[model samples]
Target: MDVIARAGRGMTRGQEFRTVVDGAWSADPAHRMRWEMSLAFVAASEAISLPVQAGLDIGDRTPMTAMLEAHFGCRFDTTSVDLDTEPLNVATRYPVVTAFEVIEHLYNPLHLLLQIRAALDPAPSSRLFLSTPARKPGFLQSPDHFHEMPRRSLEALLSRSGFEVVRCAEFGIRSPLFCLRGVRPLLRCIFEKIRIYELAARR
Candidate 1:
């Protein structure tokens, strides 16, 4: 019996969520999520007209690192840091950092964000792209989720971390159209899509 694979069944961690029990990566929801996040990052990167020369992916537990690097025309160092037990360390200064749906799983997301800010290049154009779930239609405290952040709380954390939010675009909508099959724009609450934000270091 595939114990390791079995242990990962239905897990919400990055790698586990991207992987299938039979050792295949599903492209349905997981890949789609990654693509959307990459789109956000690409848009953010383009906004500042800064090439993603060297970046860090805070918790990219998937194989999309290469794809993301290629898409951004640069390399992104990937990490699978255990936010609960591991201390945040910035090996090298990065002009760009991405933390998709990672902060909610950490005990002290603000602290982590501050640490990440410290590691970012001091250039005003340097950016951090992040996303996390909102409080609406909040999921129960499961083995995966530590906490959810509403818009106010999310903004507070970024400000406290000395990062200025450039944009915060909500995606999910909770509406009848969302339930309808083959809807062009899925209707769900902004919180549901995990609020994606583009931020820059304070001058």
Candidate 2:
């Protein structure tokens, strides 16, 4: 599939992996793991235990996608997709698939998950990786996200879509002192974390 890049609601343009992660973003190496990039990647990576020649990446390419390429020792394929509108019916079923911080942007995350189940390799060892913000109070949530699901809600949706959670974990992006900074930090203490899940399609 050809690359299709588009900006968000008011963004001037979409940013690529080079622009968004490697170039524009940096954190102190010492504590970089506290960043969402490190947090999401670590969680997803640690859960892997399979060989992959090729894979599918469900969202736009990003640093995490690069890491997946490294983890699998091969380049994963990506398509021009608008998860909110299009069904992800790829001709090839992938052994590994990733959707990093993307599902929350959709109005119907379940629709996309169903497509993913269909698109993924059906072997028990095949994996679908996903990451998104955990539930938050309305004031702490991003305006663009139409669905900020609690853990159970997300699990239920995935289950209904023919996937079963194999492994999952959550980690915060805030510094240790963040909770002491202000009300927002205290709030972020709970919401700034990202939860990552590894799933296997049901038989």
Candidate 3:
């Protein structure tokens, strides 16, 4: 399957394979329930998104970051560093928005998450937003991905790192076959239709 096609299935199914061969449909409801509570809290509060410090262009040119900025009317400061490099926080840089998309590409997700947490300015209301493929199969499909993160494992990692998940949901929608002529919005519409499993965490 192609990248998007593979990503579509991997995001939803990859993690369940390791935990239960039966299927994700049976296992994800409980996971989603936990995420819902986390998300509701974020929706009620005003929190900033974290910026991408490194690895630009991980997925589709940072659509999620731009969307959040537009929607929330918040500006973000970005830093660039590899997973192995330590994050630099200059006096001029203070980020409330730290967004990492397609981060399954990183070698150590837990370490990266911790690094991100440490880099942020300590505010009780500070929040972080993260999304990764639900499992290893999704990681394998992407040339850059180093690991696939299952829902439960990811939740544990976030919690251990002092984050409380607020919302989580599977994102993606199957596109309809055949496009009408002169409709430029078809792809955009399809993408907008894509459901994302989103999570909001706060310390």
TM-score of 1: 0.72
Distance from true location, Cα of 156 in model 2, Å: 1.3
Q: Candidate 2, residues 64-172: lDDT per residue as tens digits?
A: 5566677677787765565656766577888788776667766667877888888877677778887778898888987666668988888888888988887787877
Best by lDDT: 2
Between candidates 1 and 2, the one scoring higher on lDDT is 2
Q: Write the per-residue lDDT of candidate 1 for residues 1-203, one digit (tens) a residue.
A: 12122111212244332223332433445445645565655565555554567888775444555656766678888654554445556578888777766676666677678778888988877888887766655333324555777788879889988988787776652344445644333323232555788898887
| Model 1 pairs in collision | 172-188, 172-189, 173-187, 173-188, 173-189, 174-188, 174-189
lDDT string, candidate 3, 1-203, tens digits:
12221121112224322121133432444334323433343344444443322221112223333444444455544433444334434343233444434355554556556666665556554556565545533312435445555667777777887677655555432234322333653543233221123333453
The alpha-carbon deviation from the true structure for residue 21 of candidate 2, after best TM-score superposition, in angstroms, is: 8.6
Which scores higher on TM-score, 1 or 2? 2
TM-score for predicted model 3 compared with the true structure = 0.53
- Candidate 3 lDDT (Cα, whole model)? 0.42
